[model samples]
Target: MSRFRYSFQKIVDLKTNEKTQAEWILSSAVNDLRVEEDQLSDLKHHKSEVQETLVSAAANRTTVSELMLYQKYLDHIDHQILNKNAAVRAAQINVEDKQSNLTAKMREEKVWSKAREKAKLHFTAALLKKDQEALDEMSVSRHKQPS
Candidate 1:
């Protein structure tokens, strides 16, 4: 029997490549999200430490200027936290979008793979039928010959 070749083999390969690329994109997005989340956590931790220091200063013999400075610093930290939160949100949205794209690519790949399998099965069945016909013809020719 001849080698079975899928007519859409190129399409199947392209679909698989697309899926792999999508997976890589999704991985990158996830890494970005993780980095953003870690930065936000660090910012919150720093803000807490500053707040504690400000409180301690207030309870001690700190001057008004120092207190005002601490307050301003706290305000600055708050603004940074807000911006970091926004960044985290945006990264999360990016991850979601990448996840959606990866899902689509995977589906496309599966469709092409299934089609290839179906085509291969058809090819095998046809080959088997041809072989069986050849065998039957040979058997009939032997029966018709003199013993």
Candidate 2:
């Protein structure tokens, strides 16, 4: 019923809203990391299949010129696959790092959020007290009048 109590209630409500927002953001980051990891795994599998194809090509060679040309093409393809796979792995790692950073930020936000709520409640209480003191002084001056 007191002004301080009402102010503290409002502070609690605001903090709850902020916590819900933080949770939603963190959950989205986790989902993105999971999807990136899946893509990285698929890239690794593709690289293995490409290596197998090149090995088979080498074994089926007939003439020197034909074998050399076939090998050159396979080598080029293998190089490309290797580069692409590396990039996928790097991207996956970056996604994981982003997820971790988001988690840490969420925790820090929770801590700071509680402090923010407390400060808001305290400020409201101080304002209420100042207003009450002003009203009391006015009442005393009115009562001491020579009416």
Candidate 3:
């Protein structure tokens, strides 16, 4: 029997490749989001520490000049935390977009794969029908032979 050849094998391969590439993209985006979140956490932790220091300074006989400096440093850290929070939000949005793209690619690949399977099934049936016809022809030929 002849080998079954898919006419759109290239398309199927391309679709599979696209899906793999999308997975990689989504993975990278997720990693970026994680980094952003870790940075945000670090900033929040630093802000808390600064607040503690400022409070401690207020309880001690700290110089007024030094107290002002602590307040300024606290303000700086608070600003940084705000900026980091924005960065984290942007990274989250990017991850969501990548996730959607990956989903779309997966769907396209599944469609092509299903089409290929159906084509293979049809090819198999045709091959079986042709073989049966050949066998029937041989049987008719044998029955017509002179006894």
The local distance difference test score of each candidate is 0.95, 0.67, 0.93
Error of 2 at 106 (Å): 4.0
Give one digit per residue, the lDDT tens place, for model 1 in 51-86. 999999999999999999999998999999999999
The candidates, ranked best first by TM-score, are 1, 3, 2
Tens-place lDDT digits, model 2, residues 49-113: 76676577668855677667766765776676676667667666765766676666667667666
**Which ten contiguous residues of candidate 1 have the minimum total lDDT?**
1-10
Cα miss at 139, model 1 (Å)? 1.2
Global lDDT of model 2: 0.67
Clashes of 3: 0
lDDT for 117 in candidate 3 is: 97
TM-scores of the models, in the order given = 0.97, 0.47, 0.93
In model 1, the clashing pairs are none
Candidate 2's TM-score reads: 0.47
